[model samples]
Target: MAEGKMLEEKLFSKHLNEEMEVIIYLPKQYSPLYKYPLFIIQDGKDYIRFGKLPKLVDELTGSAQIQKSIFAFLPYKTVEDRRKKYHPDGEQNEAYIRFLAHELVPFLENLIPSFQMAGSRFLMGDSLGASVSLKACLKYPYTFGNAVLHSPFVNDDLMELVKQANPGMLKIFHIIGDQETEVETTNHTIDNFLAPNEALHNLIQEKGFESEFHLFEGGHRWTYWQPFLKPSLKYMLPAHTFDLESMES
Candidate 1:
């Protein structure tokens, strides 16, 4: 098994007014001998614990399926305050993106000897967290190179972000289940979910990006995302495929 570390309250910078509790996975043969790619996830606790994302990574890493890299689930400010921080028009959106780009990136670079800016780093999330994954990639193409969005809230704001996408140095994997209709939070239909995702796929195609869109036969919940987590990790973490091969050596 590759070494996995769960750390809390690692201050990116006190001045940024940011702190993250990270779940980090270092590959089996992790060493200071090479530069590493970065994968960042939002809804940090869900991805690491509830979603079993780490287990999926461990399986792939042991099998030598991708390149070795640093996996980070950035802790939220607080559970009660997530809505204010994650929503598109929320007050903390700018600060959150800034924290990921400016603070978190540098923090990881200082810790991982091999960290690259191009074709390396990734961001992922479920629900509102997924919205910000795409938003962050669109906002900072040079900073985050890949994104995985699962059952994201694809509303007018998401369309706005897609319209703003640069497509350079960024690849995206977008997946929504067939059953995303709800009065879960709002009076939205399944079409409401698929429509925006389709719009995004078309936009990405128009922009000439490397991306994929998948619609599964399920609803908006952790049950569906948990199963898809492995594929999500593998598709985005191409380097991990190679690393897993080497780990077996």
Candidate 2:
């Protein structure tokens, strides 16, 4: 639980346009002989700070709540650049997706076989990070069968994408706060805290994906996300064979 064996961030340079950076969290049980599933998280830095994912994995896998998996964290730009790339319509959005779908994923897979196609993976993020995860799932439904969205910043374009997805390939876990309001947005014209997220949850369920939406009694903050992260991991990476009691018992 003490932050695992290592936490690293590296610049992933592609031949196309830019040098993207990614953070990797390796579980203590990560091995070369086996392939590990991946959980690619956008808004990488925030996830690390908010979820403390690496440490959580260390503890959970230590206790056998789940299997050893990888966290591919992407640290996007700050300020305008961050919004542009992370938002659905960001100028670099497509390129960013390509970096993951085409370039980064393949690169990592070659290096670590367990980081395979999407079924063995989960896409995740908070807020806009949440929206992009939704987008990526629609984009690569077969490749990505699962998503963990925390307070996604939903919009018309993203809604369209969700509606188009094949229900069987998508399974989502969405959560939002009960008291979320407009103060969370950049435009200041729309308050996205809860309504949009709830709507999205309803729509995804209507479309027939195995999904669950939870509204907690709190505001839009990391404090809420931290406590719920373990469940998300449990849902994302199912335990191979868990028991009512320990083998040692």
Best candidate, TM-score-wise? 2
Q: Which pairs of residues have clashing backbones in candidate 2? A: 35-114, 36-114, 118-143, 182-191
Q: Candidate 1: which stretches are off by over 4 Å?
A: 1-3, 12-18, 77-79, 186-191, 239-249
lDDT of 1 at 40: 84
Q: Estimate every model's Cα lDDT from 0 to 1.
A: 0.72, 0.76
Kindly report which residue stretches of model 2 are placed more than 4 angstroms away from their true locations once superposed. 1-3, 7-16, 187-190, 241-249
The C-alpha TM-scores of every prediction are: 0.86, 0.89
The residue-by-residue lDDT of candidate 1 on 95-160, one tens digit each, is: 878878888778777887544664678888987788888888878888788989997776787777
Error of 1 at 216 (Å): 0.2
